[model samples]
Target: MHSTIFSLLVLKVSSGSAMKLRSRFQPEAVGSYRRLLCSLAASTHSVEESSMKSTITKKSIKSEILRSKSPTRSPIAVLQDWIKSGHKVTISELRFISLQLQKSKRYHHALEIMKWMEAQKGFQISSADHATRIELILKVQGLTEAEEYFSQIRGTANQKAASLPLLHGYVKERAVEKAESLMMKLNELGLLVSPHPFNEMMKLYMATSQYDKVPAVIMQMKQNRIPTNILSFNLWMNACGEVSGVAAVEAIYREIMNNGNVEVGWSTLCTLANVYVKAGLVEKAVLVLKNAEKKLNTSKHLGYFFLITMYVSINNKEGVIRVWEACKSVSGRMTCGNYMCMLSCLVKLGDLVEAEKVFVEWESNCKNYDVRVSNVLLAAYVRNGLMEKAEAFHVYVLEKGGCPNYKTWEILMEGWVRSQDMEKAIDAMKKSFAMMKGCHWRPSEAILMSIVEYYEKHGNFQHANHLIRMIHHFGLASLPLYKVLLRMHINAQRPAFNILKMMVKDKIEMNGETSACFSSLCKRESARE
Candidate 1:
């Protein structure tokens, strides 16, 4: 038998498949095989003194088998022969083969061998006995097939607590539905239930956005008398925040507060604030965010950033200020985002004087200003009818970085018009147009109209007409912007005939404003002609 086992091992080693060459015999398998060989060798000994020589011979055979690179014998046949000869091979040896087969992704073969081992005398395979082996199978193959095999032993009266990886497997497969059903089945049959499985199932429900099902899953856990932990509560809160909106989130908060043992953390408050913001309840969002800061004993820098944004969305000036103060408190120096928020909010509220003050404050602290912050301050300047300040800051940004961004140029152009500085405004617009030309970015029709309006506002018809020519040159003549120039001519009360001639020259379309303006300009122009 030993000689045949040796020959088989040699054959397997020499002509083995790629799979065999790559096989990593695990330590457990090696240890178990060694133990089996020792047990088989021990069985060859006799109680009589002279029979010790036979024991030594058996040890020599076992040693030879161990030293051989591949098994020369059929391990299963050798084990069966030992059992038939009335010697017991350890169950560990059977498990080693099962694991090896499973490791090779040969699940069907592994399962078959497992069944054969179970049918053997004194060969009871406990789930606890094979948890590690089964976990290996699950990792190598996958949860779906692993769970099918698990189910065969999982609900048996002899089964221990379900494995952790199996619980995680349910989550990975997004099979919370199956987990919920199976957990209940396990409990109904008086099986030892594990809380991890229920927790994982709840997590799975959370991942799939089926938050509505979480309460039912939690109830299932409760029915099974499994203790809920912090993770369970957080996932429940997250689910509520998703489907139930702020009201549900508030209820979750109340429950957490009532639980004296579990103090609320910063993340909980952040979540509450987020839900409140989503629900469009800005006041409630700010209030909850503030309370969260107090409760967590943390600064409100991050919270204030979100708070200010919500307020800005609703045009809540006072709320914006409050949030800004909180932000400043958190970070002593204002960030660019905070500065932009302040500038934008002040401009929208029509507090031009305050806006001017902020612009100057930003410049005085120029050493601390980020280039983006400087750009926003320029926009604020332009919006507030402060062209000179806008130009200075635009230059500042260019000196600090490169040229001002598109927004900076746009704001400056708008500011130039507001301050009745046409030539500089037109020059700025032309420069912006040139820059766009360089970058393969074109000014929209609206920008051209803004420039035309600037010229018309300053009563510079020739320059406005020149801009009209430029608009046509850029193939923007068919656009609606030329109408603004026609309207400007009529509003200027220029010679109406001359304005009409200009319109005819440009083929400008006439809308109500343009027609009326053109008629007015024509009456004046006809009198002059």
Candidate 2:
């Protein structure tokens, strides 16, 4: 009896011939099947509605956060408003928002979202979320704080997952000792079940120039029966290239091709090609690059950029143009990064005309003006001693509503300094300093010294004093600057006592030249008295 009902249901669903099923089955069975069909249809509609709602919710939340006036604005406030507006916040939505923030490099905002999630009642934060929060804390705060947070949750079931980010942080900082100690601890805890931790250790070893240790890492992986990933093989190939040569890299490549567990990727082939290029085996490099091109994922631009860079390194202009055209063909509308890469390669190859054409294409299609894109051409102009063109391009950028970044002013300052236009150089330098204030950037000592020499030669005491104060404000004051100041004071027959006091305060050591300058000033003062 049950089989008869099941057959009737299948016939109704497959053939949708309800009259035939009705003729075979009892009226009661047909009525039950109708109810089931209604239930299934409702369930599918409900799922589609939920999916649509989820997509809309994600878009709304992302827009709210991105539209905030400042990066420091609390994302929690956005969530509160979202909740107050008769909307529910799901864990999935919050996680989605956090991931988006992370991709945009807004770590502080991402951390705020994580904190909000932890505070919510009945929301079970997964181990992966905890790991993400730890990584965000490492970025927003420091490694010390991240380590402290990890210590509190070190004994949890998913401690292995939580610890990987910390290990990555250590590798990023090149803290070899801490990384090795953590690896030892993880091994003792039996948490080294995957290739991630081992790959990170290999990366650390390579970064610290301990190339010989890379093979030991691979051997350990083998002994532990941990399968290697694409990154593992790439790093191994690079370390081999660094330590041994092209032969060693090729051997590893052959092994990778044979290892069914690992899929040979475009990036792996690119790494091998790079090794070949370094060894001056252009023919071999070209062959590997062709293989890499075959493996290229058409959706991604990274491989194309890497190929262009390799071609540039080998002075293969035709190869660059071919890959570039291929990239454009695949990507109907190119990105700013794509244009910049092509422009830079063309400029490097002394194909300024082609560079200009590419720049114009970017300018025409770009929604918002990116000064960096223009800066490439501006720099090329300045680098080749075309100051007039550089100056004109700088004005053109301003006219096009492009804001100059620190690098723009830096290039202009360097060009002006080279032309011995001290006044313009000083102006550009001041602008550069202003742009670089509170940033990690510092002007090169060579440029600073050149400006100092200019000031000293012209006996420009006022500007020299201002420059010294600016340098001191930026914590860039050096012995050379103080020495130049002392000489200027001595030459101007002004009192050098205050300058001497500043040197003492700054703990600038008195070298032979400095001492001699001070002595000359002292003797002249005595004569005047």
Candidate 3:
């Protein structure tokens, strides 16, 4: 029993000592642990110390830690260690460090690091992004610095890529004068400005309405022996339409024809047509469309829309119908706006029969479309004085789950008023207002004015007065609208005296224009009373 107790005591003491030794040698306590172990190991003969064994274990742990190259150290920590250890950073490693700094948008620090790299010698980092970053950083900070850097590229053997983005950046900033100067410098540098930059320069000059520069740019093509294709001619002709008359546009067209190797394209003809359209020469617009068709050997729908729009602008109903028929023949899919344009034109011209045919053909052909198309078709019907057909068409549209918008209702109501169907017009106007109100869109002053005019035209002064009051209530009355109201009352032969008195009471100024004509009439009425 005594021997067992001695053994147990010895084992418990050793275990406790081992635990304390482990706690001391933890990585956090490595310095303390090393010092204690070094001292103990030096006193190897001490009776209470197992110094030699502990020393061996601590040396093993130190070796293991030293062998493990961990990545968890902070950048500052690694840098500090490198400085303390007097380790030299290699060129490749320094480049990577610069890249890391650049990625963080620390360009100034990156430049300093790069300068350090250059000072270290035998290090050449000439990647595109590296060069671009230096230029971009300068460009962002100071334009003069960027320009200086750009000028240095001629002397540097960096293969002339520096001018490309500099030119592009200038163009993007719309620094046209600066870009033109850069273009001259780049051309003088004997670096062939790439096609993309060439196109950009062309667009910049074109946008500024510099038609003179157009020919000059094209002349550069000739001097540089750059091929002048159909696109080049088209660009010039399009530019001419801005400052030059039709004659100048035709001269460019003739110039394209004179250039035997390059033929005029459909796009060129389209531009000519657009120029004529702007000049309000409808026949010329049609002729251009026809000529393009002959040259291209196809009637493109784009040309058709342009021709139709031109016809509408000139109020050429026959031309519109011709274009509409042409559009219908060419079939894959068409925009509803295109068809609506034709329908609206036919309605405005009072061609009810042809308009009906168009709607029928549209419904028969197009399988899917929005409700607005049907609404437009309804408006077209009403505008042509086809009330019976318009009502039937409205029913057809509703059956297809299509809701008519306020414009459609307004058109039908106007048609009713024109036909002297005052009761129906009033009812339809109320229904339209209710629908607009439901959808959180209010009726415009124009719609209400139309209602008031309709009532006055029918000699229902009381109804007209009610509508004028409603206009005020709905907040639809503006200065111009108020003038329109005063005129309507005067034309209806109603007593404008009371309204004029009210205007004076409200302190609304009656200018010379209003008083010049109505003032004498008001004075005569007062004298009679």
Candidate 4:
């Protein structure tokens, strides 16, 4: 009977195609049909042979999808190509591909896969699939489209599951009014059984600086007879510290200890320690952190990161060193993030000697050459006015295969500007601009003004004009840029009319200094005529 049922499900999955099954059953089964197929794939010899063939096909499809350099390539096109090549495309394989893309932060590709699945003739998208699609939409298309998609699924089974991601999107965006309306609706629909929704509300409140509302959210959770989890208590404790004081936060911690409903972990202890530190209770904070250390899960690096950071907050150098050594003693090799955290903490304490030691250790053991890790040390060097060391390290990083990101160039540009190496600074600025293309990074106004001042001081008309054009390209044109440009053009005996026209086009109101520069330019041009 089981064999017959499995065969029927497998047939349904294959769409009754006589073509050879070229896709292996994914280990994680999403629905009943896939689950039955997975179990049967493991039992029989003929099934095992088919599964092996399927594994190769799945690998081929995944490799093809991931190998495409263009993010805009259609996943549906890839799927169709596989189908044309005699490879059977299963829903589970599509889901697995979508999940892999999501894990790679390729939201556009993942959404394309979700859209392809939706267009399939016979396949039914479940409520859970709708929820996943809503989240992908939120990521790729933004909140408005996600809300529109949510509205279309209303009054259906997908509505309830789909509402959670929409609520989360509102919370993430800090849309207080919309979030409250959705929470009330969820409550009315009796979908507020778990503490997850309440926790989200509390998180939103905390983010908006309305700490007083956090406890109210916790109360609502209790009133609904929902059990508070570790995260709920953690947020509640943080809110208490903000609204009330250390006394109130400690009271919440005591209640958690006595209630025994939620399992207390290192995170809760870390929160309590943080409150204690903020209240200037250093000794108490240290005691709590020691206990947190006792409960710390050594397998996870985040716990050690928190401990090291808290120790740095207290200026407990000994404690920092202890935690660093403990993290190193863990079984697996330390991650790049772990090394970055340690280097950051050491640098914060102004212990460059130890920071250099940790940086060297990271370079020796790191599998991937992450410039961010090198950036921590580079920033420390630049901060200390060690220009020689900073320049040397920058060259060494390039030689060692470290690609300088925007932050790296920004740091070097600042240092060069400080040291009055205008040529080097300008070169660094251009590199930083190139790296910032397709991203949202912008040079700080202070840095831009410094470069503008450099041009004005030297009367470099050509470069100043070029720099202003670059600034305009970045949508960062301002009165200062126009003022400098007018001064340079007037000094160069060029027509200042175009500069004045640009000012008008940019809608920059002429201030006192700008009017003076404009008047000077007009007088110069009049005399030249």
Best by TM-score: 4
- TM-score of every candidate relative to the true structure: 0.39, 0.80, 0.46, 0.83
> Compared with the true structure, what per-residue lDDT tens digits does model 3 show for residues 1-529?
0111111211211111110011110111223222432343234223222342344343332222233345343343444455577654444454445445555665655555555555555655453423454444453465566677555543433435455556555655668878777666556656553343454565566555444555556656666666765656666666566556678889988988888888765557777777787777868887776676555324446656655655666677877776667666675667777667667777677776786787777777676745667777676666657788877877878887676677667777777777767678788787776675556566656556666666656677676666655655555555444555566666664456655654554556677766753665576567779
- Once superposed on the true structure, which residue ranges of model 4 sit more than 4 Å away at CA? 1-69, 77-88, 119-121, 154-157
lDDT of 4 by residue, 186-268 (tens): 66666777666676776777677666667767766666678987778887787777667888889999899988777788778
Candidate 1 ranges beyond 4 A from true positions: 1-246, 255-286, 295-301, 310-335, 345-371, 385-403, 418-420, 437-444, 453-478, 482-529
lDDT for model 4 comes to: 0.77
lDDT of 2 at 164: 79
Local accuracy of candidate 1 as per-residue lDDT tens digits, 107-176: 5545545556667777665644444434555665677776776666644633333344565567667776
Query: Per-residue lDDT for 343 in model 4?
Result: 91
RMSD of each: 23.6, 16.6, 29.5, 12.3
Worst 10 residues of 4 by lDDT: 21-30
Q: What is the C-alpha local distance difference test score of each model?
A: 0.56, 0.77, 0.58, 0.77
TM-score computed on alpha carbons, candidate 4: 0.83
Output the lDDT of residue 281, model 4: 95
Write down the worst ten-residue block by lDDT for model 3: 13-22
Clash-forming residue pairs, model 3? none
Q: What is the model-wide C-alpha lDDT for candidate 1?
A: 0.56
How should the candidates be ordered by TM-score, best one leading? 4, 2, 3, 1
